[model samples]
Target: MVRGRFAPSPSGRMHLGNLFCALLSFLSVKSRGGDWILRIEDLDTARCRPDYARQVEEDLRWLGLAWDQGGSAGGPDAPYFQSRRTAFYEEALGRLREMGLVYPCFCTRAQLHTASAPHREDGLTVYPGTCRGFSPEDIAAREAAGRKGALRLRVPEKSITFTDGHLGEVTEYLPTDCGDFLLRRSDGLFAYQLAVVVDDAAMGVTEVVRGADLLTSTPRQLLLYELLGLPAPEFFHFPLLLSPDGRRLSKRDGDLGLAALREKDSPEEVIGKLAYLAGQNPTAAPRTPGELIEHFRWDTVPRQDIPLPPGLF
Candidate 1:
């Protein structure tokens, strides 16, 4: 059976862009008679809130996008929240450590910013391997200086290739593109790359459908899957939903959030608008989730970022 998921970070309410991804993910699985899972990616405790998480679930329910497993639904894999799954991340980190593929990185954000690191299009700076070859004495010295280090995976200079369900074949070099990346943060929190890979594999997720913004992240996650001996799922990265001004919709854009949209529009109105944006429907007429699924086609979805039509809200 094909198992899919819509993992949302509950730092804020769901925006139109987030709803677009969730609807696609839901339709892709449901249309094919597959199970849909809803995983709350509340890893960043400092920013993630219980109220936001609760609101997220309510919003999805209101939108008529339900999941088969995870969150309140429950499944074989319990504790759907990433914050509650730290032990799994630690175990995976321990395996990497035993294999000599993990190292302590003492590079502070200020130090990294000053370093001549290659910047990716997504705005992430590639690590310069400053602490990749750190010795025990070197690490001890840094610890003595009251500096706690993060854990980084020792990425080899090799290329990785994978076929995206929507975008076709994609390739990236590990060391050159995204050098030894972080598996754990300096504050002892597990990084997204590590946590996501571990959770997907453990939960038996067969496919991953997310935004194209994360297309560059697939290669790094692929490396983790190989290192941790986990099966990498098929990925489909859809185009992002941009604002009328060509900016990506975010939490800062409060007017574009579900909380704001709910006050004026019905669930069908919201779903219909997003479906039209995703190239699934001919018109932006109100439609149910099941009604839209009949027209959901990966090829029909645009490859480029879509600008939100004027007066969409």
Candidate 2:
């Protein structure tokens, strides 16, 4: 059976963009008689709060988008929160260590910024592998200096290719793009790339539908899947919902959040507007989750970032 999931971080209130992704993921699985999972990506314990996670569940329930497993619902894979799944990530990291594919990186944010790392088109600074060659003495000296290091996976000089359900074939080179990315941070929290791959594989998720902003990071996750001996899932990266000013919608935009929208609009109206924006509906008329499933076509979703229509907020 096909299994899909919507993993949301509970750092803030659910915004329209987040709801749109959740709705699409729910429809994608439900329409095909598959199971829909809701995983709380609360790996950043410093930012993620219990209240926000509770509100996320309430918001989804209010929107009529329910999941078959995960979140409040119990499944074979218990404890859906990423924070609670650190042991799994540690085990995976241990395996990588056994294979000598993991290394300690002592590069600080300032040091990384000053390093000669290449820049991606999206403006992300690629790691320059400064500490990849650190000897035991160098590591010991750094530790003695009270500088803890993050664990980085040694990415080989090779290319990774995958076909996105919406964006078609996508390819990225490891060395030039992002060299020796982090698996565990100096703060001891598992990085997103490693945690996501381990969780998806363990939960038996066959498909991943998320925003196009993460398209570039998929290659790194694919490498983790290969190294960890996990099955890779199909990916669907839909266009991002941009602000009126063409910026990607974020929690900082309080007015565009679902909590703000709930005070003025009904759930159907919100879903309807997002469906129209996704190009799956002819007009922005209110429709139930089930009603929009028949029209949910991957081809219908726009490939480019969609700017929010004026007054939609």
Candidate 3:
């Protein structure tokens, strides 16, 4: 069975962009007689809160975007939250370690962002393998010097190419595109790339529907899948729903978060307006998720970032 997941990081309340991703993921999976999983990505407990996660569940329920499994609605795969899945990440990291590809990286942010550092077009400063060949003695010396290092995997100078379900072909060269990315943070936390891949594979997720802003992350994730010997899911990264002023909406700024929007609009009203914004509805009239599914088309959804119509709410 084809299973898709809507994994959201609950650092804040759900915004329009968050809603856009949730709605599209739900519709795409449901339309195909597949199952949907709602995984709460609370790996960063410093920012993630129980209240925020509860609010996300409340918002999705209000819009009637029901999931077959995950979160409070548990399935065969219990403990859907990332915070509860550290052991899995550790095991995967251990596999990489056993393969002799893992190494300690003590490079500071300033050192990495130097003027001579190679950067991808997306502005991610490539890790120049500065600590790629660190020996146990070198690591001990750095530790003796009162310095800690994050763990990085050694990546080959190879290109990873994959076809995105919505955007077609995509390619990324590892050495320059995003060389030897982090598997764990220096503070002893698992990286998002590693955690997500582990959780998805364990939960049997076959498809991933998320925002277009995460398109560049797919190749790195694909590589992780290859090294871990896990099956990678097909991706469909939808375009971002921009603010009226053409700026990306942030949960930090409370940009049209559902907590406040729900007070002013009915659930159907909110879902309908979101549908209109995604080109799935003819007008911004009240409509339930059930009503919008008949018109939901991957091709009809705009391929580029869409700016909200000012004063439409």
**Which candidate comes out best when scored by lDDT?**
1
Model 3 segments more than 4 A misplaced: none
lDDT on C-alpha atoms for all candidate structures: 0.91, 0.90, 0.89
| TM-score-superior candidate, 1 or 3 | 1
TM-score of 1: 0.98
Candidate 2 local lDDT, 1-313, one digit each (tens): 8999999999999998899899888877776778999999999988999899999999999998988889967589978988888999889999999999998999879988874778788888888888989999999999999999999989999999999988999888899887789898999989999999999999999999999889999999999999888999999999999999999989999999987899999998998899899887788999888898876788888999999989976
- My TM-score estimates for the predictions, one after another, are 0.98, 0.98, 0.97
Looking at candidate 3, what is the lDDT of residue 162? 99
Predicted structure 3: lDDT? 0.89
- Model 1 ranges with Cα > 4 A deviation: none
Per-residue alpha-carbon lDDT of candidate 3 for residues 134-240, written as tens digits (9 for 90 to 100): 78999999999988889998988799999999999999988888889999988888888999999999999989999988899899899999999999998998999
TM-score of model 3 vs. true structure:
0.97
Question: In terms of lDDT, which candidate is stronger, 1 or 3?
Answer: 1
